[model samples]
Target: MIEVQHLTKRYGPFTAVDDVSFKVEPGEILGFLGPNGAGKTTTMRVLTGYMPPTGGKAIVAGFDVFEQPIEAKRRIGYLPETPPLYPDMTVRDYLTFVAKIKGVPRADRKARLDSVMERTRISDMATRHCGKLSKGYRQRVGLAQAILHNPDVLVLDEPTAGLDPKQIIQTRELIKELAGSHTIILSTHILPEVSQTCQRVVIINKGKVVAVDTPDNLTARIRGSETMYVQVDASGADAQGALSQVPGVRQIAVTETRGSVTGFEIDSEPGRDVRRELASAIVTRGWGLLELRPMRMSLEDVFLQLTTQDAAEPEVAHE
Candidate 1:
């Protein structure tokens, strides 16, 4: 539903977004991730036709964003980091105004408004002034306005920012519900939010696309060694010796507790399953196997490794 090829945006001598390219398929939720000053918002603005790119082309829903901006924008719904809101207007009035500007038909505007308000759970605040609502409610109102026109593509920048935990969960669910019918590009700093809500992720650093893949695949790619945490009722030295007997185990470090139980982490060969073998070794050595489990890598680690790895390489100056 969205395609960008060699898109670059510059402000004088500084390149805010540098030769970035990617595709978002229909019904796919593509998570756009990066640290501050990574040009994420600039890219989003270019895609939404709010700003034109200095180089390359972007097409959304079959229309080139630069050559056919009106057509491209007609199919897109965009919500910036701080929602474009009118504080003086009530929720109902604001949404109605947006619907009119978005060219919603007079006959369908009311229905669209109702559907969006219900979907975003802002129906209760319909009559309340936008400025009077809490941050969470105001966010819901912003979401309601964005989708009120029912565009085929949704571009959301930090949609859940500033919301409480409960509100964040609710917003995540709402985004998931909208995924199948809408091609979405979600930009957020919350790694877990992307891991939970998006089918694929694109990691950008310093204005360039560094990594793009499914979350599980990206995690697997960066994982160098498998880890196993084991606890046994024995001396640390004895536990380490027992673990060494397991095939595929590369390294082990054990520490003793007050009750004669030993805690150890065993580094295994990549892609190896050492839990079963470790358990058997503990049993054979006459030590009680208190716990044995494979360690899982967190999304944060994967994100940092990929972004930092790219940044460490020296940049080749582009004319």
Candidate 2:
């Protein structure tokens, strides 16, 4: 588990991470999201003990990161944006070195190193020099080292950045497999990754945490009435009129027409489920139905909405 309380980081006039607080339950995957310069990396650095906070506190795996640096660090496995790798060392040697440095007992070092290499699908590369590995293989080596220590907490910063599509998929699957055993804090700009991988998300903006919630809840909490997309085998104007007759329909735009099928973007009254009524009307009018579904807002929409929200909302404050 990981806990951050009113964490703050400042450099003269600029505050990088301001009064941010959040918790990650054991085995939960938390997605840390922000655009460039939003303090995501800064916050990660402080949590990983790479940098100290200007104010506030952080606890990792039951130990204060600042008060008990070694204990906290011992429980964390971090893969930074640019993984720390020794080019000249063979993959096996490098991972063995990592396991030893992380305090893997001498007797268990070999077994642990081999286990991680296998899990990361890097077994074949073990004998090859790290310098000779391809970019994707290098990334795998980075991931293997991070987990080689078998730490309870894994702080991965853009674990999939710059990888080919195949490699990205492979890495995501590996992280998912590690979820139940490792409390992960994943930082990335990739929206799809968050939706697919994280249980909850923390969105940072201008050095402050603006939003924190499950992806579904964030989108469902979106302001304004729901928008639904409908298609019917009828004239565009006719379909629009029929939908307007549905009791909850507030706004209807006949957006497109392809032969006999007409598409409509309908805004419904708040908290209304007008699908049944709309369907009934369409059938009664002998208009053939084609498609109907509510347009759920994507994670990208929620991210843009929260991060660009009016500044009037209070920023999380720290003493």
Candidate 3:
């Protein structure tokens, strides 16, 4: 488990993280998402005990990061944006060194090293020098080292960086698999990664917490009124006009047109269901209903709305 209470980090006059607070439950994968320069890395650094916060406190697995740095760090496995690799050492040798420093039992170090390398799909590169490995391989090696000790918490800052599409998917799956055994705080600017991999998301902006909630909940909250996408074959008739007359229909606009089939986006009053009336209206006009479905906001849309605009933090379940 990880808890951050009003954590703030400042460098001289500049505040990199401001009054940020959140909690990651045991075995939960929390996505720390934000745009570039949003202080994501700075916050992760403080949480991992790599740097002290200027104000407030951070607790990792029951130990205050600042008060008990060693204890807190022992439970935390960190993979920074850039993989820290020694070029002169082979992957196996480098990970062996890290295992000793991280306190992996000497008797189990070899087994742990082999297992981690296999899990990260880097077994073939074990003999390759860290510096000579490709960018992707180096990233994988960094990941192997991070989990070599099987720490209770993982603080990954862009773990998938420099990885190709296939590698990214592999890394994503590996992170997902590690969730039940490790409390993970994944920091990245990639919107899809949060939506697909994390159970909850903390969207940060300008060094402040803008929103914290599940991806689905955030999408629903962002759309005040329910929206529906309807594709109709109107036989050259005006489908939008007919749909607009339906009860509870607030607004309707043509989103696309192709021959007789026309697509329309319809907005209805909050808590209202206009699909039935809209369908009836279209049917009465002898138009063919090709498609009808509720339109939910994508995570990207929610991210843009919450970060690009001035957003107030909504009440969220911290624990």
RMSD list, candidates in order: 3.6, 2.8, 1.9
Of the candidates shown, which would achieve the greatest lDDT relative to the real structure?
Answer: 3
Off by over 4 Å in 1: 254-259, 310-319
In angstroms, the error of model 1 at 300 is 2.0
Give per-residue CA lDDT, model 1, range 122-171, as digits (tens).
99989999989998887778888778888899999999998999999999
Q: Provide the overall lDDT of each model, using Cα atoms, as 2-decimal numbers.
A: 0.88, 0.89, 0.90
**Candidate 1 TM-score versus the reference:** 0.91
lDDT of 3 by residue, 161-186 (tens): 88999999999999999999999999
For TM-score, candidate 1 versus 3, the one ahead is 3
TM-score of each: 0.91, 0.91, 0.93
lDDT of 2 at 236: 80
Q: Which 10 successive residues of model 3 have the least lDDT summed?
A: 310-319
| Candidate 2 residue lDDT tens string, 25-65 | 99999999998999998999999999999999999999999
Off by over 4 Å in 3: 235-237, 311-318
Higher lDDT: candidate 2 or 3? 3
lDDT of 1: 0.88
Q: What does the lDDT read for residue 76 in candidate 2? A: 93
